[model samples]
Target: MIIENFSSEKRENKLNQLSAEFVVAGGGIAGVCAAITAARKGVKTILIQDRPVLGGNASSEVRLWVLGATSHMGNNNRWSREGGVMDEILIENLYKNREGNAVIFDTILLDKVMQEENITLMLNTAVSAVQKADEKSIEAVWAFNSQNSTHYKIDAPLFCDATGDGLVAFQAGAPFRIGAEAKEEFGELFAPDEAYGHLLGHSMYFYSKKTDEPVKYKAPSYALKEIEKIPRFRVIRKEHKGCNFWWFEYGGRRDTIHETEEIKYELWKVIYGVWDYIKNSGNFEDVDNMTLEWVGNVPGKRESRRFEGLYMMKQQDVIGQTEFEDAVAHGGWALDLHPADGVYSELSGCTQWHSKGVYHIPYRSFVSKGIDNLLLAGRIISASHVAFGSTRVMATCGVGAQAVGMAAAVCKELGVQPADLMEVTNLKKLQNELNLTGQSIPNIPIRPESNLLTQARVTASSALTLSTIPFDGKWKKLNVSSAQLLPFEANTAYAFKVQVNASEKTTLEVQLRKSHNDKNYSPEVILESQVIEVGAGEQTVDFKFESSVADQQYAFVTFMANPALEIKCSEKRITGVLSVFNGENDKVSNKGKQTPPQGIGVDEFEFWIPERRPEGENIAMEISPAIEAFDVSNIGNGFVRPWGTANAWVADLSDTKPTLKMEWDSEQPLSEIRLFLDTDYDHALESVQFGHPEEVIPFCLQNYTIKDLNGQVLFQQSDNYQTINAFKFEEGFSTKGLLIETEHPSSDVPAAIFEVVCL
Candidate 1:
């Protein structure tokens, strides 16, 4: 496993400077994700990649689909919510590339690096040499980009080697192990009896589509004669339709550069031969049009030089045999091995060994053991051959990136090197940050809920006293009973009592409900009780109740003391309809409806009572339509109208006659009124109003508005106007026969109200 430098020429031409807080080498998935994470944490970061594009193996040149653990597995499950940067990339590409699956890979990787304002991407740049002032710390590095024929000397407090090749560790003189370790070292069951000269090979991926039309094919220009003797040259079913990565067999045994060159030439020949066999070889004739969609220019290397981190992960660690205090990531993939060379050669064949559930990955595996500042990510992390076999996948590599970036930020913030930051406290902080961002970490068991009580207090006023108690525990079962002991009941109606020490005469209204779901339903019964005020201290107040309770139901007790000492009974019902629409086309129609009402064209119905109304009550009609994509033809014109304007009004039904009661002792109450529609195309109110007679309140209007002070008579005919005022304003507003106006004149209206506000 020897790597030749090839040249000593300094390709870096730029001045050396200390700028970024962190420097990330390699523009692959791991590197880019690392840069993104670091930048998101408010760190000034720089990303350096030898390739022009950000994505390394999954780039267009090397088309590889990113794979995580099995869809159903836990611990090893893919937690994509860790929304620092990678999540953003996936979402952007998922929306942009609807036709091309591979495009998603490229788009996601590029977008992450591009969107981060704190991250600087240096593409087509390769690190030439490491500048270290101490045995463990890297002061800066010299980098050269062949594309620009220039050099750059970058200085940073933290450096990451996401290059998959572990180049930084190689240059920094890190103590890294390349080949398989002796069995005595790790004691892994899968390890060879002794160290052996064997390594997994790389592959050049290509995609093909089978069509209906007939077509001829030829083998790749680099195909070898030995390929004809291979037995596994076949296509397998994949997730995508009409697309397969089946023709990927090359760069094994022989020198990668030399073999890849040869395989490139032979692939075309192999493809044609395979297609010919399927079409004309008597056994198969249905397959005629085989289309080649993509071919990899760069070989997808599986095994390569691995950096030696402070801790070398072994297969035992993956078998759940070891626990690490500094665990930053978890791996669960099986031990999959690909032969080193030759078709089905004894040592170069594919084999797999499954392990137990989840394994811990230590932070030491990220930073180079010999060099202090350089942190390695991706498949090149410090691990034995067998261990690397289980963690080499893209998803695992992304996890490694997250760990390294988080560690780098921690190091930068604490003024410590990555190696030193591997302490338990620092690592825990890193793990917390990763978990907060949604990355999956090894689970540490947590005790069930205890210490249920959070806080409790009572607020007293002359008229009314309100007491609120907060509980942290999840409510399992609740009951309310009195000494006039109401028996504790579950999911049934019951009256409860509390002993109170009162100083003066007072009346109490007792109710029970859960905090979160409390306001949702009205209590079956409200117990009325009286208490005499005490000088001080505690007092027991008993409440009596009659019960015919149902089974399997639960209830909590709540008590309210009437400040005014008045008795009253009432019932209120809240109702509203949800509308749906096509989000993509802006089509207004009831379709897919969501809770809290979300969809392309959905609207929510809401009601509000204002304190300023005469009855110290306010009534509001609201239509909250999703307008993120709504098209308003004209600011003041083309406004959507209420279903029916004349019948929408807020009034006090408590009066002898519901004569538009607009005043209340507590607050100003609005009376009955009708929403009017002016036929003049220019004067359609975006929102209609029907509150206090003096206030021509607007309802459900777009935010924009226009004015018609010029008084231009656009419509002279009286038939164009509609006056609505048929319903009564009650204690609670109610609607019947209310027809929403969905259409309005196309002309510009004076103002379009997006929402209604009653003050």
Candidate 2:
């Protein structure tokens, strides 16, 4: 290498011009999912992220757990975990990184994006300028990378702004809102006043580890010296670490976008001050050996600029559970909002209100109002400040962004603007495309005509008859009210016998309950109540319910809290069956029931949640005149997940070699076969910090084989953990009949499948 001589000239980085069919800004979960989905749809796409890694707030730099519809199973959204590309990412994370290391998660996101050949990923690159083809549409975008000293100009027909702050949309002259609206604006009763808070704040977290030797920490002169200034200082405990301190926030009243760095500095001072108290203050236990392992330099921003779109989601759309005609995605995280003062305020950290069921988000919310070629993703989507509280969660944003990505493909195919896809016929096509990929749009089932499996005569080896749930000698304490959610048909009578051990003579209060909305799992409709007197020892209690409903629904056989009794639990785990407890999950809900203030425009409901794996065992009980709901014909029912019913065909527990056969009238050429398996959608797969108990969902089929008419094996797989297992033949084969043999995940859990598609 040779030294260069100084010259009297200005130096500029090399400029590069590139073009793609679709362009996505921001490398957060939303943008990553959008770019991946678009690429998979055969669209040439470019993903640009300013950060060094993907996942935005969910990245290692700012580690926030990824949560969505299930809301950590803290509410009544049964089987409501998001599906599609987002689901694949979460499942892969669980399979390889169950420990939930944020850094490991980063690699997983990168790996997923790399797997798609149509995608070009650019990391550590920020979009600096927006070029408009006209006053209403985006023509291209300009980005710069300091690390490489390069500038890029990317042109595209369509653009998606998933940059969290709506940078692209903002620069393109798209309309956006920065603060909360008054109650009169959208008729949102939960709308906060100006003094309470208009926007959610930014938060920073730190990780600490215990060392063999004592470690000392010294606060800098700039670090906050007075810890008592924070109103909720007493909430800090020696055990509190990482995301547990999500309330360590500030800068909601200030400009969230431009003042981000200033807010981050304030958060650092607060974190250092809290650590200084933990190490030096006399209010804690033995923390002498505890040392700071990692502290986030970047703050996780919650609220920023929310852009305007074709339609703006409002408060009623969430709480009322409105079903949109052009529904593309769903969200169920509580309508959670923080005060303007953040950590400094005395308000109870956040005010949360949950819906009885998941609500639909329309496609119109993703298209920019005035910008023709621009699309909105992530927290920047068109939504009122009231609705943004729930839609702002990462997983919800991811699923919605998936819709945007898919819409881009449809737009390109039709050669139309985003708004054109909103037409009834075009919208249905878009929805069908999304459903084909397993995206869950609430209240919308797959269309039967599209699936070749629907044309075949379906038959199974055996079907499960709900006769009894055998006890495994394990007793579950009735310290919290528990219930068994059983699906029942209309005009059916069911009798159950439960075994319970009582510490003393007590009255066991049992109630039969169901949701007012048959599709929801909230136990709001109490059909009947029975009180049984128990002796001082183990005994059996018999109860019966005669249903007189018009439609099939899940009934909650609830046993109210009685500390003196312990109910028997079954080791057998089955598809579409779960045991729930009315309890508190501090992560989402503080109390078992949500009793919002009267005018808040939110419903009051009790949270019946299931425990995670190795703990969420069903209550053991015997039912008279067995219920037969898992029929082989369910495989072509069009619904993939539990919707009002199991919507799955489960084989008998004794049938070790479970098989499903499909026969056609004539020989047909099959090129590809897709199977949708059960993945315990109830389990919230948080991407980081919260580790899962198991790698694979217990209900998934671990091993499976597919054969032609003469029992000759065509395809087989082992160690499968994903929900969608697909097989394709390079050269298609003609078959009169098809057979699928599957092995159960374990002996106790029966094999189950939702839907099968042949192409």
Candidate 3:
């Protein structure tokens, strides 16, 4: 061992200075998406995280499931799963870790960030100080890593604060609000009063495992022994663990940021106390073999400081379903708020108010109002408290941050401030760029001027004429009302014939319904009704509706609740086709129907949700005239996902080698081609806990090949399982005609694609 001389001066940590085109703080889903999107756009980026791993609340450290607009498929937002980089991550996780192992999720996030060569990732680093260049611009940021005892000075032209708590915005003197605004502030009738609590709180989770041998548990001295104090303690059972205790929360009344430690301790007291009750109170069975597996140290935070931006989203913006011209993202989770007293409160754990459909999130809400170089993201972006209730979920946050990331890239390219992109000329550019990546803005189709395919003639080898879905699957009981969503081409009336078995003589009521707003799945408008006379035993019910649809839309062939009958289901599953049931999903607080209080400023509608696969089979029916919307011409319609109608080109199931051909008058130079296929956007790919049934969505294309005029293969991919498959060819080639051959993922499902673009 070598001896060291004593130093007179105080020891200083090592200092380092780094620079990039863009900088992002926090490594949650929002921050990860932001940095990944920016880096993918060729912007030199730096991503700093205070933790060792990414995913923030969704990390193994916190263990909260990743959910957003889809809301566990428990709400009326059908086919509303987030897209772009957020979709990429969720789908990748579903493919690789459908079991939802939290540790595996952590690896996926890390792998994605590490794969980006443009991203400089700094883990276990915290932003401790801000250096402003002027009154409204950030010069640099000062962050320190305790793990290495190093201080860093990171400089970038643009900075995004996705740190949930708005640390960067807070330090830069940006305007922000901490608690709920009064009802009069935004005309939000859903705003909470003082007694109802203003801010959402923090939560912690723990996992328990059962062993063959008996296991014993010992409670610490600080454990909460008085379990009866918690009002919902009786709801806990031996089978429940981890996210089952999402309501085990605290610290809404206290400072969520500064008192996080105190809140964590309180959560610990509750967790150990509950485990003690299950192990020692003699209230649960087979608990002697159960032992605590993992407990989250850092609490999963819900709400904190919300930064002010160019425009703040209010309750009306969400409830009214406003479509902003500068719409960059969407939100559909209910306006969910919790009681201030948390677990101790006698009131319900949460109050969720849903809208009629998913609402647009404007780009104005992402740019800071004061700071020119600063961009806001995640739950901290501008929004009133009542609106924050819907936008604060992790998946919504991820997509919002993705929009912000793309905006930062555009700002860098145009040499302008973040707010400057709001102009009509610039806003469309941003929206088009996002759409190119398969991020859909509701009601906004890709511009014809931006896609070259719109000018070419598109034709398919064979298109599907869907007249029937044979009754080769299961016979589902009519425990609740069920409906089959059928896409109609235009103002056409269609008749349906369905097979059903009745236990007793009963009149089966059939109604044709549609959404008042064509784009939404909420069926509120009844077009026609028929009460059919049926006798006991299996029989066919014929429904003929004379009224024609006003436009091309999905009409719900609904069978009212009649417990005496069982309807047949089809084994075949197709893209943009589903069977929904008006039922309750207790996990998401949908009690069959939503009947809110008179003055809550919300809609009352029945929740029609599709069951998870292996159970959500399509209803077997025969149509008089087949729907012809699945034509080759649909490939250039500009819409990427199903909108008001089935905006997809589906080949006949018998066509084993489905081919699409595109030809131009003369030779055209091309370098890139993007294929937007069907990946069942309706399924909510929750990051953890809730395991998925299939590794790959059945509608996705498994293999495909692109050919030139000479019949030479230009590009080919096998085992493809994503919604978007983009291929780029260096040293571009000239082709007068292009042909695409696709293989269906399975025999029962037909080959389908939404859009194809050549650049």
Candidate 4:
């Protein structure tokens, strides 16, 4: 043997090197969405994924359901579904994979990436080495492709750690924290008193099918020995399979990363033993034909490592519905947190509390605080343990990913890092851009510089004006009891006015009701009914109510019903002012308590009709305007809340041909026009896990035609789809004004423009 104990030549390992503008790690929903957004904007993007297929937990291997603002039908999440890419993905699944097949879902995700020409997808590749230029920036990443046994050296100017565990951030020396933070650290009510290195845990689920013949089962050696030791195992049924048993989770108290394989083994035992109980325990009802079709080999994880960012979400932010100026996303899920012991815990599966509505998520939560070149999305973003319980869902994470991707593209254009996005002026520009892409940021208004409606004077055929806000003073049909909402600032004087028309002689009683508590939606406090006598035709009443409303309070002016009284319907949609406690035929279910379908329909299209009339058609009552003439600032003052009732100008429904007309003081550069047609934004976009609803919306504008002032037809569309209508021309024309003639299926309904945006 030679003294040196080595060959003269040193071994050299060959590696494949590639360059890109942006490199995203992980192929989960967040990574997939981020890569898609950047690639579509012409960013040279590289997506490295450890799995063979896309969609981390949502893939066929893990079989976890894709849940977001809908919260899987819990938490009274009406109109809370996510928009943008998430909306497209859910609609696609409903159309293509109606049966909820996981295999077909994988193809749908793959198809999305393939459609983007600029995205370089490398699957079955695990990132192993991180090369840093200095202490602050990551220069390159080396990932080994397991499928082909090749090492890839990927170099990019900017990087996104969308991996759920924050792998790239950890390896790049980025500042981050693992496990839980102490209650005092963030002042989070849901946080633990003492900080612990524990996680929310990993979960696995199984699927079952029915068979004609009885199926037999043999327990594997690693199967859980004691059936009595497992919790929530009796829930297995013939119709019950995936997502129904998210409680079948474990491995939280142990190291979720280093011990992942061991945790997977433990989950398998629990899954098989649970199925055995359903099949052979003899306590089951009709299970002779029931058999396990598939069991997840890989456990789906909920939480792992969270990286530090400019802002960390706290429990107070969620419970208080804190408004952030730089908000880019929202979450409506309840403050859901689990015991660290997971399935083995003696306590219940989880503790949950709902909020008033959706809470805002600021843009500051997307970038790294210390690192210049790194950004993060997905479950690994900066947030307290309790806050993550709500934001960790796939739909919410996808929105954060979209924000990060767009920010990356903007950074490239501006020649800056992720930190520069926090500038006040730049943040507003980003918000404006996001609104254009159909992302909703509650309470934020579109700036006037780009808002076309703000620059043009608008006039409608007829608008049933009420208060400064639309729909707050409207009353309508089968007046079992109608309520008008009064929004007032503290210490400000408010005049409550009511105009009533009586078909037959009846008395109108008005009650100012106050909200009881958080749990119940009932406005129980009757602040004394101010009654008034009304004759046939019309009568007006005015009252100066007691000034006790605190800041941001909404008082319901409840008007007790009189069968003899009928309010005429207004052509313009009045949003929420047409609140009726109950119709003569409306009844609740006999079983569980049901929040009556939010929009206009459940079994019938009742939402389209605001109020019921005893002898005639349903219509909204006309409210005298604060100003005599229509204002240009009326439509696009920017707030599009109250869902269906945003400030809209109504065209004359009775005119031979009703048209929406806009005029400007000077020639305005107009290439594109967007119309916010009236559709039920109050109702949600369903996943179709339940039965599908009516495919066509009756209240929305059905057909429309557009042309210049000269009457030359520019564009036209029929069999119109969706609540938001857009018309675009590449070769734009300079014009002072354009006429929009909308055709409706029914003369009773006219085109109501909530926001008419042009560019």
Candidate 5:
């Protein structure tokens, strides 16, 4: 059945006028991040989302956790380093709801992009058709919103198809491929010998809140009762909370868009039926009131229309067989395929292929070979079915988004087409820019540490022998005291160096043992045959061992008997300090040692600031202040009270007037300062100013400016209107004294700052 709204007139007036330099179609994670990246680079960017919210699948509608690389990968792995806008979103969300689970993904992501002034968001809008003057380039695109019955004709120099489904590419006449490919085409190991009308399945996620009281539930009409009797379906447990492609029983070998709607309805039926069986069958008698919390409105799509670009990513490239000069992104997810027959079967088993480290994703995969300006990102990038399976994860898609966004910015700046940016020089520049923003670019090798053990010394009463070990040079000798213990653990191992002032040849036996029940367990010492030689300055030794304690326990070894040796023992002790607080008004102390007033407190504390000072004042102090837990109505009021200052004031501090200062031990370079203000209280802050004292200019500037203490302007902005405005300083610039000048006089506005963070 084809349905068309013939009476609906295109209301063009409701559409926002095209004024941005770049336009991003789709408001999913990739689209939002793309828009934010472009806007952060000072480009006028407009983000168009078909839904009312941002985050496509990872939103409240889908509720998918954001997964990155495998656990064996390094912390700074390729998938983990896709920063820029994505990092900002994660940091903001993590800071806001540190204790809560990862349920606030959509709200946090949306707020990040929506908060940016340069990013104009158009929600509930769908791209209808592309208007191109030339076959190679897009002049403008027409979009319509059903809610408002409006059509938008957006014109921009550069365009990004972050629409997960390749909607823009398809509408723009870009050649694309969908479903699985034959093995000979991409030579994918998992691909069938011949092309089959099959593709990965989509899933509709649902969540249930556990309870104690029994609640009855009814199975849906479409519940697969007969299929449940099958061995494959019977063997699988339905008690687990998460259901991905496994719930994908059907919807293959059909029109994806059309089948998706029907699949969603069927999936919902199965989901409710499972819940009903659990509630009524007495199996979940203890689980009372197990109500459905969320049912995914948007299906988590696995396969889609992949646009054919200058280069097509193949399975061999993903298997680490090929490398490219224009590599801009990488992926490492397994090639997981769902059953094509729409029923649980053994063939639905997921396939895994190991790529040693990161695999390259070329820049040519972004823009279509058929269309010049249209750059496709996210899961819709040009890749064979098997390759797409690996690169289709959210983390890999984020990397692709970063590449496309940076490419779009470069094209807009250089006045070149997307295809033209694939040259070595241009691609290198793009890679460098992405790297600076902390985004991972593939094939650019990472040099390992030359020396892992730097200045290693052993402090023990017994004689010890040190041996040089060979392994991957990439491992850095992390500070032993900085190692963090996992949950259900008490202590961490300590290792360090010892120096002998006086020359005394002594036998020192180094040992490794478990410290439990107030006694050493399984003690093993590496004894030296001869007396160890000691130098006048310092004797360095390196030793590595693992603990055998169970349940994430810790162990440390001490000399069995104190051996007489003229040496100074330097053992590495845990340096990080943890503090707990009672309430907003209570003072926080370190293990009941030093009590400090806690106006603003945090549950967990990890201080990385190189320097600390009052926002305006320059006097510095070296104090490892205890991290406290407190709550403030506003962040400005949450700070340690300045000497002789009583109340919080909002004044135009951009100019030299109304200066404040903070003193700390070290010097920390600041990119931006976030001032959390209590807008609900007094509604102060008409206009604010901030800059270093050196660049004193007595003018009521509308935007904040980054300057040195000597008053040299580094950067300036006029538009960000959020209360948490981050004044970013240019590279190679350092400034002190961030003044908050207000639009109204200090006497008129009563705004208070809760917290001031420089990141």
Candidate 6:
């Protein structure tokens, strides 16, 4: 005989009361990442989403491409990728939905959330009511699920508002601001001179398909009758579809939160009008078979109410590239300011200004200034309008989400509020925990409390290697004795090697110049030069320079075009280190066809020219600077920030047997051995836009072996592509030293690592 816990009336009412350490609102990637982080940290967490599917803008309902540090479309962004849970999602997506299907992506997010047993996820449940525990704390949230006709009252100690519109914050009475701030407010340069209540606006998207048979489109009754009256409507061509129709926006003057429904209808009307014009207009061809495949009813919004936090990100901090001690996340996207009038503004789609390097996002931005338990994530976090323009990107918001989630765990564990975690010691613990979990916070190394790796002396296989290349026995001359003019963008110091062709045994004087702007790609300041002489045919010349023009964003090498010189160029483009000019139409495939090699799109400039375009990964330039700025000990130093000079260990490919060894001063007690491999310390595991435009570079050590000092094999992994490597002994062991042998991936790449922890 069994006894029932609930009464018949209670069971009939379908009321459920649940409790957890954290309650997350919104099922977008931000909320999902936050919930996953907390759940993985052993905190009892519950995630609530108003929609059935997760991933707010990236969901099937509205497929906004994940654009982050790549700055939407690569405005000279280097070593950019949002790692941690965001990268984990991307990797899983690549493995399962390599084609980037929206539905598959939805399932992937769901699968990840479901995998964490500590998290209780409620779908299609809207949080309608909140019960305040006190003036600053939320005791419980009452939500309703119409699908199941049930009411859920979730009681939690901490809460996160990952909702794009900041609904949770609004309902909780957390102080927030709507619309743009005046330039005088935060002394912002990008802000409007006068304050305006107008917002960026709402946008809907549609996709069209080409069927074999003819298809027709009937304009919606509410579609704008005189589409020509609208600004920028004439620019719409039939070819524009899906994410391409980002300009179909509306509702700038109206309250985006209160009048969201009205904005949605307005954007829909504009979309239909644009679609009708594309199909009916005589100017558009190849529309005989095109039909609307999918249209977004749910508008993806840009800005709404932003809750105030302990610290607000300002424009100066972003563009100035301030090195903050509390930077928990980073963004490299330009300060993209769109007109408040949105779709109807007679201005360029948006104005953008690039940053010198990736800008930092502080943890204080997520902590609520007033609400004790409330934390802000995603677009709703505290930031000026100018800074919001960059921070609002999906990938950056995702990074903030992980940060806030990890902080929430610390709050629950320490029995403290979100605001209390900002103290130095407390923050260090949280920061170290985040780094241990693969989240990168710039400059800040994981605390040196109990790390044993710092105790071991670290040495690597090869310390120096010169860049070398073997050509396919082909060369082209620039009408004068010259070396191929290879262009690149380098934010920091770099070493360069160029392949050149010379006639009559001439010496080449390489003059390095930095570009003044994106347009007119010609260099401004004449920095330095290196002389390399080559014999008649094809030859590779190495130019090792000490002084680097690290201040500029653009750099190019022009070989003095003499009659005795021939310049050879390659197609492959390197990040900040190398790439050939894009405007070369004379590119010939190795098959001797008229196919041009894929190169950088310097479409705006006509200056830089390529010689005979070599196909494949041929940047025609290689740079391997001395890693003296970094040492082997930098790996276990616990500073996990990508690209931070002190955060990684780089081995030169020059050595015959490239290896890394860790020797203890004496026989040390070692229970576990952890190895971190350098998979290109700067290039993160994050990608924005459609799927992954790039992959984990081949810089990752492909083959490696680990041995003890007594010549004993402990562990061996031959196929390695991941950035982090960890190993734990079942019991415990005492050893004097450890040996890490790194073999050449092919004969060019060397071994590299970020951190190695010994426990």
| Global lDDT scores for all candidate models | 0.48, 0.91, 0.90, 0.68, 0.51, 0.69
Candidate 6, position 213, lDDT: 99
TM-score of 5: 0.60
Which pairs clash inside model 4? 461-652, 476-611, 477-611, 477-612, 478-612, 569-619, 569-620, 570-620, 600-607
> How accurate locally is residue 41 in candidate 6, as Cα lDDT from 0 to 100?
85
Clashes of each: 83, 0, 0, 9, 50, 12
| Segments of candidate 4 deviating more than 4 angstroms | 1-16, 76-78, 92-104, 234-236, 461-634, 640-658, 676-691, 694-703, 718-727, 743-754
What lDDT score goes with residue 61 in model 2? 92
Task: Tell me, by TM-score, which candidate is best.
Answer: 3
TM-score of each prediction:
0.54, 0.98, 0.99, 0.78, 0.60, 0.81
Ranking by TM-score: 3, 2, 6, 4, 5, 1
Error of 5 at 404 (Å): 1.1
Worst 10 residues of 3 by lDDT: 191-200
lDDT of 5 by residue, 1-759 (tens): 998666677633576557578889988778877787778777788898888777786666665554443312211111122344554454454345433233455667767787789888889998888888687778887888888877788898888998877877887788988777887776665677888767766676666776666445667678655446333544434445545324544456556666789877766766666666556555544556676666666777777687788888877786543668887775655444566645444563444443433467888888788887788878898888877877787766776788888888888778888888877778777876665454534435211121111111111111101111112112211111111111112233333332333334444443443322211111122211123444443345333333333423222222222234332321111111111111111001112111223421111221111010111111011111211111121123322111111112332222233333332233445555544332211111101011112111111123444444455555565533223345555675444343333232122122233345455
Write candidate 4's Cα lDDT for 415-490 as tens digits.
8888887898788877876665556676566677787767787665455334433222244543466555433234
The lDDT, on a scale of 0 to 1, for candidate 1 is 0.48
Q: Lowest lDDT 10-mer window, candidate 4?
A: 600-609
Q: Please, what are the lDDT tens digits per residue for candidate 2 over residues 590-672?
A: 48998888888988888898888889899999987676778897898877888888889999978879999999999888888
Better of 5 and 6 by TM-score: 6
Off by over 4 Å in 3: 1-4, 193-197
Q: In order, what is each prediction's RMSD in angstroms?
A: 22.3, 1.4, 1.2, 8.4, 17.3, 7.4
Model 1, 372-415: lDDT tens digits are 67889999898888888878876667777888888888887888
